[model samples]
Target chain A: MERTPVLRSEWLKIRTLRSLPGALLALFAATVAFSALAGVSEASDPGFDPLFASLSGVIPGQIAAVSFGAMAVSSEFHQGALRLSLAAVPRRGRWFAAKAAVIAAPALLVGLGAALAALLAARAGLGRAAGGLSTGEQVRGVVGCGLYLMLMALFAAGIAALLRSGVATLSLLVPFILVVSFVIGDATGTLADFLPDKAGQLVLRETYDGTLGPWSGLAVTALWTAAALLAGAWRLCRRDA
Target chain B: MTSIDVRDLTKEFGGRRAVDRLTFRVHPGRVTGFLGPNGAGKSTTMRLVLGLDRPTAGSATIGGRPYPALREPLRHVGALLDAQAAHGSRTARDHLRVLAASNRIPDRRVDEVLQETGLASVARRRVRTYSLGMRQRLGIAAALLGDPEVVMLDEPSNGLDPEGIVWIRTLLRRLAGEGRTVLVSSHLMNETASFADHLVVLGRGRLLADTPVRDFIHARVRPRVRIRTTDPVALTSVLARHGHDAQEHADGHWTVDGARLDDIGRVACAAGLPLLELAAEEGTLEQAYFDLTGAETEFTAQHQEA
Candidate 1:
């Protein structure tokens, strides 16, 4: 069978699911809300990068994006949904590809909208402090921030497919992003640049002192996402529904 | 119409074989009852046939092609492995719409199936709110959406009300009458026996008997004759003297074992006994099933614990 119908079917699944749409709404609200709050706070340090400060809301906003990706695949495991889905499409690879596409599209779109909104809301509160930022830097930060959020969502989707449970995926990912990354990064500086969350966020910074450049940092995160996706595909094809 | 051919199919899960080297053929124009006790591997065999699980050995094919190899599998064969296989949060219509969309089926087909399965009124409700019977009806609707030539359902009568059961029986008969292949797996032997023309019986993951429903009963279960005569006392004494085991009922009926209708008629005529009623009876499929599975237990020492 042609793949177009399968992709459309997967898109319908995401659209019809309450949690997925709710997650996207939360991603927009949390990112914009937190960034605006940060914009009102005083700049505590001399080395604060205005661009990174304005985009910092993504730290919390990314939780919603990852939740969307994880929930999309995890729902299939519940109540034998995967069996029905596979019965309709049969070929595991085609089904997985269609499912991954649905996750990527929404995550990317919501990520862009949230990233742009966060930048504007923060810039409004920062006043003159944000004025010194170059136009090219702001543009790069917005675009990179959007791509970074999408990558995290895709990464969570991959894990969800492999684990076949939303709770398990969220349990592992949320703690690693919130606690492990900060604790490990604070303990060691150079190694933090290669971590997926830390490396990808480097693009949001106006001035960086990390070993990886903005684009190169995204490359590291992209590689991690690719690895997770490939592993998920392998698991999905090899296992019985 | 299509045919199902399962040859030496086997599957092992955690070192225990769920489906043994089972072989059977289901042809069009009849409802083939796939009957077995609980844990007899009926569902596992169905799963293997649908390509939902990779068999450890051998193969199962529909129309001479593996299920996954078909260009449009649902158009050729529609299967319902589990009734709870749908996402609970979506409306019944949306569930079928998305499934129909995947196979490139039209929206009208979804509405048609809903109407056919008596789910049209509840199509807009979330599956979570639907009863188990409603879920079962939705599953049947999905199976019939493509108007497939081959239909496989694992216990379609489960969770259905008496009316729903009767509806499915009529539907299966209608599909078979159209020269379509229908394989229905159920542990309800008598229920299946009523609608199915053919039977493919399994016991402990092995083929027990494969024959027509009537033939299976007559072949596996011994024939019996019930005789009611004007002089029951005389007939009982005569039968005992003739070395025949006969059980007497208070209503002047004697049940004779291993006696043909012709033999009884011959004896009654020679004895000049007036017969009020003489009828030959066969055991039901339910009894035959127990005999077959009971016999299997004597030969096989191991079976699935699940």
Candidate 2:
């Protein structure tokens, strides 16, 4: 198939690596298992939302996707392959753009797959308690969750590019995503609503809180990704690799 | 003509100067061996030429333009800075394929390079599985994938075995024979002695000498003439009178400097000295390199400082 040369090359690089597939498989397994477990545990709860339970797998699944995205660029630096890449495409900005496009595709696909699998598992496990979701709400929840995962992955990719170390990027990303968000949510009453994960979770809810609606919350999460990516691009352009 | 030009390029790392006011030209149709000890700025100079690192002052151009300004730079200049710097998880072919794709080079060219560098047998294997020599071959293959006009390799034979080393030497000679400019950096003077047509020597971030390889070898290396005679003491005195320094070895042989074999034989005949053996001892390029850059070698000074 005819494709942009840089993007096609990046896609080949990502798919050929053993870690990329391993990460995706782990994301898929973790999402499905977590959702199934959540579904079983909440089967008898009075106000159980099947879709919500199904999508709960995204909590852990995002980590895998984030690592995949981060490794996509950082591995090049670690391996010294970035030198070859730069020698081929001397325009740094265009190379960054192509890398972003290549990473975004699988992220979106796997994310959507995980979200869908979680939703289906939750629906099946809930049995009679599962309410029929309206077509609009169902679409929003599924697409929003996928979009959220994609942006989260991009956020990790940006941080990895900036730091240029896999361990350091993971150390920083894990705490911010898994722990600091909760700490801030408990410590600050209203300000915590703006945190990426919290803001992103708002999209999966059918009922609106006083803060933001589904699409707006997704938009906020996208803004966060864009900001991080812009910072990464700026660093990439100005700094010597 | 495709060539590399550096105009007063200087780079500083913090307070330490890595490269200072270095300017030289690498012309096509010749192999220019860049000689320098560690921290003498050979790699830094190559990085400046490739635009991988920014120069604090001055500019470096490839084919009359900045490297970054070139459209599809690999086609103009191909470089291999570090052989082992590649991602370990990637297969050898995948590594070359990605780089070729970026330059819009066809996949066939990637295969061609793999075969050319004798890496075709291991093309499907991951780079981590390859030994150091194999990895060096892969790096060279990647550099050649673009079929570039100018090729630069820094310390290309650092970890290679004897066979691999010979392979590289031959490949570099063949590349230059095809009318491509090949610039290779090495600290081993023996490695570049017979392979390089031109030499650019660096010491303490400064250009020490840039001349033809033959001229460099001849000017810096004095061929020692060894002679064994019954009257070694008399011969030593006669050589000293002729302004030639002769040192008597413990084995009763006199090693004379600044005199060729013919001159030694003529002197011995005239002085009525019967010589048991007389021959010219060719000095290695290693001794010549030491004589040229030993005084200004930065790594040695750093060791002393430490």
Candidate 3:
């Protein structure tokens, strides 16, 4: 099969499922609702960072994106469609690459949308409730938030590829993103900044500190995503489907 | 000719052997029936042949190449291992469409297969709403979408009604008639009796019989002359005297093997044994299968004792 055709086939397989729309809706709703709420609450604090508050929606919204990524690959195993897929493109590496590319497209689009919506909602809500973020800081936060969400989605896609089970991927990822980040952040104090979510969130901060700057934090998250994807690719290629 | 060839193939899961030293050849222009009971390494062998499962030893090739080596695998070999494994939300047409896209099969060919498989009416319906038989048909349609040179179906008749079974039989025969290699796996011998010209019977991960269907049947199935007589014991004795193997059934009927109707009549007349009914009973494929696998049957006697 031609590369373009394989990609098209994988895209159709990913999009045809009802779960994709459901997951995308969940991501949108969570980002909008949480960012709006965070923006309003943080408006009263004196040292509140409007940029960070605006991007706060990503904390919860990424779970939806993670689910989307997980289901993209896991659905094949669940439905036994992987057999058909393998029958068509027997070259495992090419098939995996096609699937990865197709999955990344939606993840990137949905993640960007969620990140943009959250940033905008938080900015409007916080600006009206208290004071608006400075123009430069606001732009940095919005851009960083978009990149952060995309990286988070890719990270989840890697995890999904490794686990190859929707429930297992969700179970493992939810705690790491939600609970572990808090536990490590509270216990390690300054050291916790290196955690995946914490390090990645540094990009959302309006004021850039020498410690874990915006671009650097985004790079950290990208590195994590890259490492996970490499591991997943290795596992996928070596293991029997 | 397009064919599937396995040479000393072996697959091991942990310490247990799933398929051990398995070797077989399925040639084109004939429907090769793969027969085995449940857990007899049938699916494992197929997985190995398709390169879905790695072999611990040996190799399986299709059309002289491994499955993973084919540029367009579906065009070379179409396989349906599971029928109800498709996404429940996708429509039948979409399911086939996605698979067809992999091989660049035209949209018109998709519709043709749907029409051919009688799934055109329900083509737009979600697969979740389909019955098992309908799903089987859809799976077959998906397999045929590429118009592959070799088609392998694992238990295609499974979950089919009588009419569906007949339809599948005809379809397989037609595919083989077109000179494509058609390999169908079934536990039930009767299902493949009329359609399969060549038979590959496996028992406990070992090849029991690999020969023509007719030859296997004739060698394994014992034809009996069913005789109804007023004096069953007398007829049995008379048949035994002629060196024929005869047994008196519980229903007071006599069944004599290795003897024709003429021999039975002659023996009966000489012994003055009155025969009410005498006819040769043609053995079915099921009986032939039982005789072939009778020694290897692990549960029959246990069930009888139970």
Candidate 4:
């Protein structure tokens, strides 16, 4: 039928689910809490950017965003929920699109709120130290961080669809985002910038020496999310529920 | 008008064929029992019909269109593949709401089904806390959210208590009485016999019999007469002479297969044998089903007599 009804149904599912909303709350808490901590601390490094530092909490907080996306899709795989979902919607593509849309909408909304709160919390501590920041730079950092978190959540969601297991998606992603992205960046300079997480996080920086611009970095991450989602949809159409 | 039509439907997993060229039609206004032993592909066939699984060959349709091709399919066919399919953390009300919203069904219908299934009292509780029977009621509620013309349930009575079983039986009968195409699958022949007017028997992923329930029983099982006599010796010898082999039971009653009650009475009267009781023994669905699928059972135990 019409896609609107299916999208509404998916939104209801997310609202009713405690864990899905809980993940968003955790995202907000982690981003604000970490950014506030960063704001209170003084960094001696000459290269530190105050705007980036204010939103740096997202580095760890993005994990919650990834979880929100993964768990939302993975719940369908548990206890034959996918069968019920498919039976209700029947059109596999329509149902999946609705699911992805619901995931992206909430992630982006919460990401934006978290980014704004973190910036405000951290700026309180930076005081004169953050005076060099312009309104445009601060706005970009906040907005970009929000979009960055949403992309990460969608990226995790796409991978979750392909694997059809939330735990597997989390296991692969949690470590890669936590360890490999950093280690690889230190070992291989520009190449690590191409990875989905590293590329997307570039938006949160006020100044960057990377080849990609803020929006272009986010675009690279979007491409990765799209590829993962395409793979997921292919598997959904090809495999029996 | 919405009937399930499955034609030459086939599904294979890996090298093993789960459903083999199965063909059957369940008409509106009747309860068609999809009967088979475990691993007989009853579930697989249902999955194919619902478009939950793709058919390796052939097609299944409802109202002249494939399941996925139908817009707002839940309003055309409501199915309960697994009673536990609802997410455990969501309340029963929310679970039905999700399905209702998907089909653009009114929210009032969700409460109606919950009340119909006697789950309204527990509608606010999380499904994880529900007993199996309660979960089954919730599943039924979800299925009826759209008030679809065709209702399909697989092994719905598995975890229900006797009262719950009776409830489902009445519900299925009422659904069929309302002219809906009702398809219910169960491994137990006797259970299906209670509510099913038509039988679609399957064995080893193949159609065994598709006929009226009464005809299915009468055509497969031999009609027999049970005779209780004061003089067993005389009755036996007389029937033996008349070309009827009488088998004696432990209950002191003699049974003569392929013999009518009237024929037995005549022989007893002509021979002047005292007949305490002479009646046609009722053929049970269990016996008829066993006779039909006995050979098709995947794992058959040695006969008790053997």
User: What is the number of backbone collisions in each predicted candidate, taken in the order shown?
Assistant: 0, 2, 1, 0
Please write out the lDDT profile of model 2 over residues A1-241, one tens digit for every residue.
Answer: 1238878788888888999888888878887788877876745666555566767788898889889878887886765567667767767888888888888888888888887888788767766655666677767778888888889888888877787766888898888888988778656466787887778877876665657778887888888888878888888888776
lDDT of 2 by residue, B1-306 (tens): 799998899999996889889999999999999998888999989888888788999999988999989887888888988888767888999888888877789999999999988889889999889888888888888888789999999988978898888888899999899999999999988888768999999997899999999998778888789999998778888887778888888888888877799888888899999889999997778988988889977656444632
Candidate 1 C-alpha lDDT tens digits along B1-306: 479999999999999888889999999999999988888899999888889999999999999999999876778888888889888899999999999989998989999999999999999999999998999999989999888999999899999999988999999999999999999999888999889999998887899889998887767777778998888877877777677777987776888987877877788778888888898976665777787887654345577765
Which candidate's lDDT is highest?
4
- Model 4 stretches astray by more than 4 angstroms: B224-283, B299-306
Relative to the true structure, how large is the alpha-carbon lDDT of every model?
Answer: 0.89, 0.83, 0.81, 0.91
lDDT of 4 by residue, A109-214 (tens): 9999999999999999988888888999888888899899988998898899999999999999999999999888656477788899988887887788768888
Error of 3 at A47 (Å): 4.6
**Docking quality tier of candidate 4?**
high
Which runs in model 3 stand beyond 4 Å of their true positions? A128-136, A188-191, A208-211, B228-237, B297-301
Alpha carbon lDDT at A42, candidate 1: 96
Would you list the clashing residue pairs of candidate 1?
A: none
Worst 10 residues of 2 chain A by lDDT: A42-51
Give stretches of model 2 more than 4 Å off.
Answer: A1-3, A43-50, A186-188, A208-210, B227-240, B246-254, B261-279, B301-306
Judged by lDDT relative to the true structure, which candidate is superior, 2 or 3?
2
**TM-scores of the models, in the given order?**
0.91, 0.92, 0.93, 0.93
Chain B TM-score for each model?
A: 0.84, 0.91, 0.93, 0.90
Model 2 root-mean-square deviation: 3.1
Query: Over the stretch B1-306, how does candidate 4's per-residue lDDT look in tens digits?
Result: 889999999889997888889888999999999999998999999999989999999999998899998888888898888988899999999999998998999889998999999998999999999998898888888878889999999988989999999999999999999999999999999999899999999998999999999898778777789999999989989999999999999889989998888888889899999888889996676988988898888767677972
Model 1 bad stretches (over 4 Å): B224-282, B295-306
DockQ of each: 0.75, 0.56, 0.73, 0.81
